[model samples]
Target: MLLRFTTLSALFFAYTLAWAQQSNSLFFMHRIPQSNLINPAVQIDCPVYVGVPFLSSLHLNLNSTGYSYNDIANGTGTINFPALVGQMHSWDYLSEELHYTPVSFGFMYDNDQYFNFAWTERVESKLFVSKRLMSLFANGNTQYVGNGLVTSNPGLNSFYYREFSFGYSTRLRGDVLVGAHAKILFGLAGLYTKRNSVDIEIDALTHNINARWNPQVNVAYPIGVTTDAAGNVTGVSAGAFSPLPFSLNFSNPGLAFDLGFVKPNDPITWSGSILDLGFIWWLKSTSRFTNDGHFVYRGATPADLTNPDAYIDMLADSINNQVQFQHSNGSFVSFLNPKAYFGGTYAFTPQLLAGAHVRTEWYPGRPVVGLTLSAIAMAKKGSSVSLTYSVMNGSFANIGAAFNIGGESFQFYILADNLLAPFYPERVRNANLRFGFNLFWGCKQKKKKLSIPESSGGGCFWTWGLDQKRKQHGVK
Candidate 1:
């Protein structure tokens, strides 16, 4: 569990990933074929689109609300433990989401129906902390000799998996569009933790600490891991993971569903979707640990502070003596974080549209609710550009943009949410970017154009009056 927590945090810092990588900026870019990734119900006019295999999407996100880099160090690069503590909240936490797409494609079927598929790998994790836990680790418990602290809030959850998806969409009667997607999931790795309750109190007279702790942890590892007499890991498992086909082994399997709808009312379109409603069962190389009852700590003496190493050793010994972890081997099931979206767009003209959306994405104990306003400029040649401003969670200052360069045979698109993070991390807490290339086929015309004699001196306009309307519209 310690390794799982620390390693995930290191990866976020090492990669400098941020929170706003859900590709929200591309949602309104109508001409971009990738818009469907945001909402399966979003039907673009693309007849066929084949993504550039592994280049389809690579996304990373880091979630946090406390301790920006500057909070821990002043401009002179000096460690300020006091400053860092001051910047922390009652609960400080961080999480990450990573995604890699191996293959993706979309095609229109039965004239009005759209079909799409994709294979993706995903990793998601969240690390939580309580102020009491932080103070206990940093300043020690003696500082608050009489304080009763609650340290049960700390939590950690991480999951890794692979997903294969199939989606279909078609227009219903009265021009109402409906879509649904089914996902098959394969679990690769996981660490799930639940803290039932914890309470701690320090007796002012004797400086004796009484603690009540209850927690549960479950994990999955590759084969050949050695355990000690107490079920503690004595050695790390060795080997690289194999990306074998999911069907080769169904040791871990899960299912999910996504449903979406779009209703176009002339100048306005209303859209909504429910996404990632799913779960996965883990059966391979799984284990769980649980702890209950009380742990006591005789507060550190004044002399103990002089030798930091001795003090830590004593604390570790005390914790081990009091907290008995019961280990068990078992299979467990986990659920995916689901999301909901509602949005509407108003078209001022055929080429200009303004839209706003309310999108909610959830984590174990956190739900991110975002509101975004976007404007898209669509071109007749299947090109588009969009700008967006979003407010989400407790932090704002999220600005995003997307530009799609379209051609007859190929399309390239770039999208970013929270543009400020790339340039100024200090002021931006969330950031994201998504780019991809797709080769596509356009809609096929069902009815051929009528042949009209140019020599007639007057084209199909003789009686239809359409030529006059076209001339009025400056169609030439």
Candidate 2:
């Protein structure tokens, strides 16, 4: 019940006041090494760029499709739960995800290939509680004596770990580029329920309430756990724990791969990528819990409507005493939810570029899909800025922006999608921001000439191979 309520509180804002996982504005800011994370095929002019480690990249994103702040806010700026419930639909579910990258960097090899690496962390959560269930919790089981209420897939999953990634990108030939990033993941702490289905049945006359819980809960390095008489986890753990920065957890290991392709053309550049195709294996210090049987709640005496607190206590005590968890220890493999990106950019001028892309994130629940249109204004001195409009998870009010300010040797960049949610915190459902600094080398061209034309360097489409101007010799 505690975990369930916590997840509900997270859903109240509909995951608003948080960032979107797919920062559309940053993804197209090619001048920043960060774009490579979205599309490995993207190349930066810098031959080498190292992140400041811990300060290099900090990212956070939270988004939802079920509800928004506007649905609950009244003229008084107060929370109205009953009002929020009216905006919910039967099929609507709350889903949210977050990612943080504390360490990252990229280096380009003279051989025309780029090597990039980073350590990334992630958290994902989702819940779909039935209206009947909420009503029962709020009003009581007396209203619906015969109708069974279900709290479907109520889960809050936490994954704390680090990802060491090695990425490589190069030009296959003229007008073509390819890249791939392979990742090795180390799980420090995790709690997930791969399978969960719960239902509450109320007896009309007997007033006996029955709860059917069927779930397979997995935990890694969990704290504050209490087992039942049969070794089942009647009480679960919740809170935050910090993990070692560089140590390896032999028990928790996983792998992921990212592949991208760029087809540079005359006026237009086409690019696409498939991200996070991988899975993790949990081994050491892991536990799995499942319900031993069912729990029947008849209350202490008769259904006491005057004092709700007593009824709740009775329900909890009954559950703890009746429902035993079967604990088992072993290993488990969990697959990563993948995402696909496809977009094309048009060069309006040598300094201006516009593009549109589609991003689809595949999860265990419903997939998150969106369309983004972006434009970038590149400066002659290697500085650049971008703006974007995105429509995700069936909402169409996401407006984002990005800017890179720095010299060839050092670069500072920031990006945000769904930026409006912060100011109008009372009406939006998604928000995010990503910022970082990098030390770069060789962003500017070297005096030495190479086999590839100077114009073929990184930047807009029409400008490829057009960097060199003639000496302008004249008759004496």
Candidate 3:
């Protein structure tokens, strides 16, 4: 009863925030999402006050753990759910969130590939207008929604998920900037299977079943037909020759926010290095709502099997009432969105920069701290290279090199991460390689700074229209 009630409540909350809560952690460059300790505006590679850049990035992440599931068969933890193995069960999310204008659009995909020949896929897309739009609705606020799951073959392969987010920033004064993001969520699950079973009527209190049926257990049984005592018809199962695994799909979106600040160098005062700081606030996270029902196939009498619809109604009714979910199952953890870090970049020399950053993520209480060192060679042209080392439960590192032609006309880059993983997975390692090229089709020179004149204000002659007034004053 407790489990059922909690599941229902999760479903309710998920519905309330379904489109707002999502996770996109697959990309390594998601510094803003992974570590919210710095103002994203300041991190823009292009000149500020300019247009947003066109950007595309791809990232692949892999996670695995070893454990035993006694409930399945002895303590073996064999693949009872074949489709839930390998890629399907791997917890990784993908997103495209860097776009132009005050609005942004992002798509996220997550899947768990645990068992071979079985798989799950989830896709999510988000559209964000300025949070200022909140005033347009009542309470001066409105919720955002995103889609995160799709089931193609149904029972053979299923996907599940949750996501939500929002961000904002404004100028406190010249050189001081602040911003934040908020998110909300909900989720659901779908299941499809080639095989099924039937349970016969028994005393509700005693829990003694009078009969039982197993649709398929071995290659001989397959999934097309079932028999009774007289070898009579019981169930019709198709798709046996094609052999598809049972599948389920779920989606949830939630709400969270991030606040940040940027303090750039001040040439007139202290020539100090640029400083970046950020804070993220995540709340109201919910999980997926797997339908709570036992299904039935052909030839099962009403008394022979419990009504699947009744179970669904009961769960829905529980949702109508408020409740909280439990995480007793494997891989389930205490839920809360964690705050993270995002500040870095300190210049040690005219051509050299070094910085450090730290961030904490939810679900596993994992903390990552990293340092980056980069240098540009002094030459007629320009060349630069950078190396980053991150330490967490495991150590991760990356190396990147950039070459420039004619100072700004042409550029080439090569980047790699987790190079050490190939040498050691258990000893601590991870890696990837990336390359990029950029060129300008047209050349335009920067305009020279103009000098303004200062008049009777006793300021420099190049202030406002002061140059003309200075001539008049000299004549007088």
lDDT for residue 263 in candidate 2, whole number 0-100: 84
Give model 3 RMSD, 1 decimal.
19.5
For candidate 3, write residues 222-305 as lDDT tens digits. Answer: 235454564433454643332232222122333334455544342210111111122212111222212222222123345535
Which tens-of-lDDT digit does each residue in 75-190 have in candidate 2?
Answer: 46665556655655443445556566778877656445667888777666654444544556545678767777666645556666668788988877674779999999877767
Ranking of models by lDDT? 2, 1, 3
Order the candidate numbers by TM-score, best to worst.
1, 2, 3
Superposed Cα deviation of residue 229, candidate 1 (Å): 4.4
Off-target runs (Cα >4 Å) in candidate 1 are 1-19, 71-92, 131-153, 204-207, 223-249, 444-476
lDDT of 1 by residue, 1-476 (tens): 32233334433432343354656786666566666666777565545678888888777777565555544554545545555556666665676778888799887664457789989888988777655556654565677776677656466789888899898888676556788889999888888887565677878888676878677888876545565697654454535566574325557889999898877665567778888999999998787777775877676688998998999887777766566677678988888889888898886655677899998877655566778899887664557788999886456678889898873467788888788886777545677777888886643223233333322112111111223323322333
RMSD from true fold, candidate 1 = 7.0
Q: Which residue pairs of candidate 1 clash?
A: 18-62
Clashing pairs in 2: 18-431, 19-61, 19-62, 19-431, 19-432, 232-325, 455-464, 455-465, 455-466, 456-465
Assess every candidate by TM-score. Answer: 0.81, 0.81, 0.36
